[model samples]
Target: MSLRVEGLCVARGEAVVVRGVSFSVPLGEVTVLLGPNGAGKTSLLEALSGILPIQAGRLELCGREMSRASRVVRARAGLSHVQQGRVVFPTLSVEENLRVGARDGLEEAFRLFPELEKRRHTPAGQLSGGEQQMVVLARAILSRPQVLLVDEMSLGLAPLVVKRLLPVLKGLAEGGVGVLLVEQFARLALSLGHQALVMNQGRLVYSGPASALLRQPELLQWAYLGRSA
Candidate 1:
């Protein structure tokens, strides 16, 4: 199974943000979406998650066409999205918030995030930013999604925390989940990714193996910094 996008276009009323974007994220692999700010990475993710209408093209999750599906339907069909920022329910306890969409995997969530297990009864709003991010991750993991979309997950977190979180995403990919990660830390994302996709000016500038990009930093420099590769 895989998440397939073809000739995708996204708009925010009157203005187009993503234009004719296309890619494939097969199961058991990580596809890193890298770009500078305002490069339309987030807009692409939003369109895939059904949060924004697809202005054109097609989206298929696990072989099911889902261009017109609602966000909740897509989620139920094994597409999970963890958007930027702490989206946990502030008034709810950590465990309560986790239980909202979880059909199972409660223990697995706790196992991946022991910190949350220890503070399961605590209000989600009281946790630190990193801890809250973990809560969101744990909840998403518990859903056992076929396609997981994570946007800016490591943003505003400590380096160590970012390090810890990335491995978990890798583990998920290893377990047969298609993970599409949008991140600003280009090197770190490439390190964990099986495939690297770079966007610039709302278009895909590069799409290839992660190792190739890592071995030749010039390619990244050309895509991101406009230097010769």
Candidate 2:
């Protein structure tokens, strides 16, 4: 049930962005990817989601190879990705946008973010940033993914809101949903992660217990503050 990546290399045109990265995400655990900006965290996630082709690499999502597969195949196999920018359709009602994400029905999504039930008829564009985030997260969960890739889960939110989301993520992890939480907040990211990896220049520089990351002030300052994380 884990997402295993081996010798992953991603590129755009002639420029290599992620170079030979490798890691394993055990089932139900929260494995976080941390790095400064331009560390290729998002790019790596995109490749796993099958939204971007892996120029060179091997990815097994819940035991199925995804590098050469379609995005739909990846979706059906419990690999869900919630991108940084909310991608809800503006023209669609909140419920409609959610319905699009639901593989089975809307109830799964509603259960995750009950507020959406109240805003079911409203257009997604009218919602606040926090609300929009809920929509994206709930929608991803609607598919009943075993593995979830969350990009910047704390971005553009108040500290209180971020605090609230952390518990939900922890609950998910406890329930056996493997999560790859890509974030810029070093302190917060390490706290939620059972394990963490730091990436730089398209390569992984560190892979160990998340607790180890909290102890290194120099690494934390360099990883987050160095490049606008």
Candidate 3:
């Protein structure tokens, strides 16, 4: 496993948003996390990335324990997180954004996102939503993380643009990077995933093969509705 999270718990002030969640992201595979809004998916990713402290859990990356590691420490340990909202340096050019973390890997990033290569010199703020997302993803890839946690990569983008981005994640998984993806579009995400984990009311309602969950709409509906399956 590239990333192992066991009995994870996260609290927001007095409220506990994530409760006893556990799952693993294996190398060369995509683990799709599905749920409705306010399901603690973002909080879980934040905890794993060390942006938010975990209340209780065991986090292991590439066989090393990093439960209490700082965000920079986690990043250096081959963990990268592409957060929601397409965060980027608005004034920076696409190529400049890719160069923020590491000087190398520019070629690889451009290769992975050829559309970016065309606008490498353009400021990120001037690009479209999908292009900005591509820039964020490209920056994360430049870090060469062993495990990548992406939250809502398709947010606010058209279905056509989302279709273009989803395959890139699958390709990364095939290249031996463990990818944990939290997506709103369940069906599209499941099609490219090997494992599936469904969340509801801050807890996991289902965990199994992606294909298994894909074939059973009732189970997913139950999970989304916060009903046990």
Best candidate, TM-score: 3
Q: Per-model C-alpha lDDT, please?
A: 0.90, 0.83, 0.93
lDDT of 3 at 52: 92
- Per-candidate count of clashing residue pairs (backbone under 3 Å): 0, 0, 0
* Whole-structure CA lDDT of model 3: 0.93
What residue pairs clash in candidate 3, if any at all?
none
Question: What does candidate 2's lDDT look like per residue over 25-109, in tens digits?
Answer: 9877889898878989998999888877898879998778878988888888888999998778887898888778774668766
Candidate 3, residue 41: how far the Cα is off, in Å: 0.4
Worst 10 residues of 3 by lDDT: 220-229
lDDT of 1 by residue, 1-229 (tens): 7999999999988989898998999999999998778889999999999899999999998889999999989998999999999699999999898998585777888899898899999999999999999999998888879989999998899878888899999999999999999987778889999999988878888899988899998898788763323
Task: List candidate 1 stretches off by more than 4 Å.
Answer: 225-229
lDDT of 3 by residue, 108-172 (tens): 98898899999999999999999999999989988998999999999999999999999999999
TM-score of 2: 0.90
Q: What is the lDDT of residue 71 in candidate 1?
A: 95
Residue 165's lDDT in candidate 1: 90
Q: Kindly indicate the candidate among 2 and 3 with the higher lDDT.
A: 3
**TM-score ranking from best candidate downward:** 3, 1, 2
Error of 3 at 72 (Å): 0.5
Candidate closest to the true structure, highest lDDT? 3
